[model samples]
Target: MNHLDHGTEVNPIKSNTKSIITDHNKDDHNAQEVKAIVRGPIPAAAVPDHMWQAVIANDRAYDGQFFYGVTSTRIFCRPSCKSRPPKKEHVFIFQHAEQALQAEFRPCKRCKPTGVRLPEQEWIDIVKTYIDDHYASPVTLNTLADISHSSPYHLQRTFKRLMGISPNAYVQEVRIQHAKERLRGTKESIADIGAKVGMDNVSYFVTLFKQKTGMTPSAYRENKASNTMNDVCTPD
Candidate 1:
């Protein structure tokens, strides 16, 4: 299978789905729900019966664990899901949204994976969309807060809390990725790519690029170009 088209290693732990949807809230069914899951490093050790009991008592056991953001429906469910379980073999688990997106998983409208709090996810969603659309433009927390209709402090914390990264850092990463994409695919000059990504100084942009990617913009372009030539000459 093509590695680009296949996502095997990231697949979630599978569970036999005797039943899918349950009427009980996950809290009420904690005992069985916890039993259904294996936390920490999988295949290393099975979760003990008492360990599951403890998880039943404390609902936050899966806080840092990888979870699958199923794309067919707008929901991010745990690997050990018993309620309305998706096909055991078809699920993907991610450590966070970054990995989920890397695997082409979209945000779930139902569970709202980004925002774990009530009424907060919607606000964060708007802010994230704004950032994605305008990442190339120079953004300040104040401007973002104004558009988000929230305070700068709130925006900063909420973004960090939900996205697992700061808004500024997210913007920078996006700009860098966008610039790299352009650099690889377009005939744009280095200065133009920098300008497109909202960097005023091309030299500064090169510095940021090197810091993040361990290579200058020109160096990266050359590498991509060489690889392209090699691929073109390789046997079919």
Candidate 2:
């Protein structure tokens, strides 16, 4: 057989076929990439005006259709939640409760949007723990209610029903217990101790201390010192 010339030109048909096959492969790759993007998580739906209206109306008809989260409170609720309607700016719409939760919003205790209600006792315990940690700050019924994501009246009633006292009472109790600890452990003045425990009014602090412990702060401090001295002097 005669040898082919080294300068022989590439076949136009074969060259064109190779280019078409390469382009086809690229197109297939691009299509696959687009499909992967489409298969990624769908974004939450935007809140429409009607959704806001539904929320304002407390329309139970829209309950499972969507959930709304309040940015200020970081709480999500069903559309029918009886709690006050949040400002439109503070609201975010989520198609599913899981999406809201994933966005770091807690389910509303009152609305129970997660289909599971938080037990009253557990909710009160959470409130109580918050008080225990923040008792040095100004704690009020409305503050506790907001932090607990319940209406003030409902929180007051449920807290009392479950804990045997109002939220404010529990806050006072926590403050007083801390005051007692500081009284026993430190020589800080009674007024300073009261202020440290969130009771800035010395007279009120003294009176409330008396009401709770049957003695003024001064008396309590003195009593603690006397007991300490007695303990130090007594034989073990």
The number of the candidate with the highest TM-score is 2
- Model 2's number of clashes is 0
Residue-level lDDT of model 1, residues 1-236, one tens digit each, is: 65465555542333223223342345446545543553322221343444333223333445445455433332454433333434333444455655665565554433345554336776687667878888778888876765554578878998899889988888889889998999899989999999999897999999999999999999999899999999999998
Which 10 residues in a row give candidate 2 its minimum summed lDDT? 35-44
Clash number for each model:
3, 0
Number of the top-ranking candidate, with lDDT as the measure: 2
Flag regions of model 1 displaced more than 4 Å: 1-118
Q: For each candidate in the order shown, give its overall lDDT on alpha carbons.
A: 0.64, 0.81
> Per-prediction TM-score, please?
0.50, 0.61
Per-candidate Cα RMSD to the true structure, in Å, reads 21.5, 17.1
* Model 2: residue 36 alpha-carbon error in angstroms: 12
TM-score of candidate 1 versus the correct structure, residues matched by position: 0.50
